[model samples]
Target: MTANLSTPPAIPAGTLPAGTLAAAPQPRLPAPGGLLLRPWAAADATVFLAAYRDPEIGHWHTRQPASADQVREWFDRYGADWAREKGAHWAVTGGGGEVLGRIALRGIDLDDGVAVCAYWVLQAARGAGVASRALTAVSAWALGGAGFHRLELDHSTRNRASCRVAAKAGFLLEGVKRSAAVHSDGRHDMHLHARVRDDGPPA
Candidate 1:
């Protein structure tokens, strides 16, 4: 889901412990061409809410349709995560700061020193390489800045678009976890993918 920066509570340093899979410095990066990957801000709530309300963006992930108040609450919870440096959320935008979608490095397993990544793009932004670029930007940051040696991403077996995004972001197909995801409709198989630190940039 796209994160709202106005959510408050900036990510703090050293909040994560030094362990095999705990906190590590991630690499910083410049925004991709034709796109910007910026830290989320609270003022972005309207754009975020609009994106979420789009059924195309909302249906694939676990997020249910949300109201404006619900969106605010979501940002608050995400802010708490950021404050601890346990994860990060970014707003994917156009050159002039038009919100296109949301991307995040979440589900950090501090003990394992790894994290899972997820992203979504607005319907209009689809097929424009927005997702691929965002994924690359975040992946670089995760591996370089966070000292995280490994990253994971997964998509439902039927979600070809997501699977493609994962691959375009440099994640290698690990395998499938049969009947692992319980979607709104029912359970479904999941395709797991991983990217080691040494993997080259997302193609």
Candidate 2:
């Protein structure tokens, strides 16, 4: 279930101390390929709009953003999410700090010590392993200092590329949830993966 960040939930038993996620100073997280994970800015609304138009992004996430206002609203929501302690979302930026994609740890359930991680890369950056690098870096931070016990990720079984990303980032395949979600195409089964606080990277 989703967390109500406006009122931080009870911390899980083995996770980090209470207020750990809510109290941290927001900043950019350095990553490979000169990538920096930072909060999305209003300036990136156009880029955000462009990325969601990619057929693949629309295929999975469903509902293409029809206007600049929608994207701007999404950007605003990301900020609000952090303020409410509900979750964190970042714009994946390249060396020059151009928005390349987005990555987030959402649906945070503090009492259960879990969050669902998601990412989507711009078409220009697709083959460069941006999603994988971002995923690995964020997962490490979430499980380590953030004091999360587990991070979950899922993709439609049809999304073979995402499955590869999860495997490369050390999340273990749990099982398939039949007809777990609906996409633009139709009802789809979801392949689940997870990483626990003390679990080693999957080989």
Candidate 3:
């Protein structure tokens, strides 16, 4: 009796794909309705400061920028994060390069294929579906192009506007995390909204 012990062809390792899992590059993702998702730049400090002045913005994102110097520092960190494949943040802009808002996919978890989405539109752009548009575009790209399986977005239940944006973006409301977050105003019960790879067509 004889037995055969043959070695199989070696599989490729460490040849990961780009635009997924690990941040490689921020691809140009388009947000229809006259919007573009571009990487944040140092020159955007002024616009960011302007947005930061909005009451809703200040109330929601406690870290209100006090000076252009602070903004530049934040910009530097954002750049480093992208280069290190840590996270992706983008400026929601218009045709003339006017900054309207910000959108980001941060806190990425490769093990669970999860990432948290954060976004805000300036006061001038509110009620125009800007956040929803940007969120939908970014989330789709993150799932389809970036290879992330699940995207999560949370907002203080008190932020009715953010809830609307999340709902319009097709992120299914996934209940709440009681006293899970502290906002500028106070502690909040965070409403967790999420979308998965198999969630099907975006709404």
Candidate 4:
């Protein structure tokens, strides 16, 4: 008997439905200390540009918007990413509704229930637990309500601040990826951290 090469084998269903994220409007998550993670808005162009222009932020995040128009375009792309269930981005706002930072889940794979988290805060917002709080809030939502199984984040090994934020958010330190990231200075080792749905709440 000849094997049938044209037929493909069956695969298991995805962990989440296709419309899990796109079916509903993106939500605004409230974090501790009166911080809110809301969808990015058109009016955020100014602060978005300013964030990229920040030396530390620029050094870490290499993609910088050259103008307000470019920033707006990026915002549009972010919305599109949401509709496509490809990614989710949020503007971290303070009690007064001022943009203090950003948090996002990139490279989403619903079938695998996995994504990579990224975030940054303005200089004024640093040293205040902004990143950790926002990160923890988002992780809870993603793993609980959104049905994601795992979330991962990595940063240059030299960035002790980010390491602390990841730990505070309950992302256990996995291991190091040698020369895995590039920064303004040069290529650097990256420390990988991750949280699974079973990790429970942040301690």
* Best-matching candidate per lDDT: 4
Worst 10 residues of 4 by lDDT: 8-17
Candidate 4 stretches greater than 4 Å from native? 1-14
Per lDDT, what order, best first?
A: 4, 2, 3, 1
Give the alpha carbon lDDT tens digit for every residue of 150-194 in model 1.
789888898998988888888999999999987767888999999
TM accuracy, model 1: 0.81
**Of 1 and 4, which scores higher on lDDT?**
4
Give the 10-residue window scoring lowest on summed lDDT in candidate 1: 20-29
Q: Which stretches of candidate 1 lie over 4 Å from their true place?
A: 1-29
Query: Which residue runs of candidate 2 sit more than 4 Å off their true CA positions?
Result: 1-13, 16-18, 201-203
TM-score of each: 0.81, 0.89, 0.87, 0.93
Predicted candidate 4 versus true structure: per-residue lDDT over 69-148, tens digit per residue: 99999999999999999999999999999999999999999889899999999999999999999999999999998899
- Which lDDT value does model 2 have at 125? 88
Q: What local lDDT does model 3 show for residue 158?
A: 94
| Per-candidate alpha-carbon RMSD to the true structure | 10.2, 6.1, 4.0, 3.6
Better of 1 and 4 by TM-score: 4
* Per-residue accuracy of model 2 over 1-203 as CA lDDT, tens digit each: 97778996664565555466767656678877789999987888888888878888988997667888988888787777776667899999999888889999898877778899999999888889899889888987887767788999999999999999898889999999999999988999999999997886445
Clashing pairs in 4: none
* Model 2 RMSD, rounded to 1 decimal: 6.1
